[model samples]
Target: MTTKTEKVEASTKIRPRIGRWEVDDHNEVALLGTRCAACGEVAFPEHQICVNCGSESTEVVRIKGPATLRNYTIVHQLPPGYERPWVVGYGEFDGQLSVLAPIVAASRDELHEGLSLSLCVGVTKVDDDGEEMYSYQFTPTKA
Candidate 1:
């Protein structure tokens, strides 16, 4: 019989596409950021030094809540190795942290400025080693 830990490990074989995010045992995705201890400023992707006060006192923090879509655009021309077009947008969380990521939607008409977005993890690409890679993206929250 398989153990619980083994089952979880086997099910979570997909690796993160980047170092800025992580997937938990429940498959929940959270973006890592840095919060300045001195100035209370938050920066995405985490930072070693605070951009506001130039202090090295910073701690890693998880970004939460639905982000507000500030702006977006559809890209028709993609770089080599990419087959389909995609939508990218700038979203702000808590009115403080802003992140630029791919927007997953059924159609371009579904997207609009000031729309609420939730963070989620999805398969992005397969590495040369044939392993699936996952990345964080923003999806429109259900009405």
Candidate 2:
């Protein structure tokens, strides 16, 4: 947990994280989530308190993919951590879940809603000190 120098405790065992929620892209391989017992609403980044019903009681879960694309954007501009000219946007799945992720669409013409995709773990980039930064990306089922 130190800056300027990077060390990954265990690369093979490490998973994605949003705040304290650990996202394991294995069994339930999409985005890890939580559902509210009170309202049956879903949340990403796994919230303990449901925003929909304000319920403290919740079930931590993961969304398996075979997801249908909701909507997409071809990014001619890339963010600080992204490669230039990458496509990125929301990938909507069943159960009302949507993930804001990079879409590995073959071409801009091929991007659209309802395209089938799956979750993949990959090295996004190498940082200043040569640490391999990893993340989840949704790619077309065949690609």
TM-score of every model versus the real structure: 0.76, 0.73
lDDT of 1 by residue, 2-110 (tens): 1122333566556433437666666556788889999999988778999779899999988875899999988778754332687888989987878988888637787
Off by over 4 Å in 2: 1-28, 79-81
Candidate 2: tens digits of C-alpha lDDT, residues 78-139: 54666667776677778577777777645776677778877665556556556677666778
Following a full C-alpha superposition, what root-mean-square deviation does model 2 have from the true structure? 6.0
Against the hidden true structure, what lDDT does model 1 obtain? Answer: 0.74
What's the lDDT for all of these models?
A: 0.74, 0.66
Off by over 4 Å in 1: 1-19, 24-27, 125-132
- Over all chains combined, what TM-score does candidate 2 have? 0.73
Q: After TM-score superposition, what is the CA distance of residue 5 in candidate 2 from its true location, in Å?
A: 18
In angstroms, how far off is 142's CA in candidate 1? 2.2
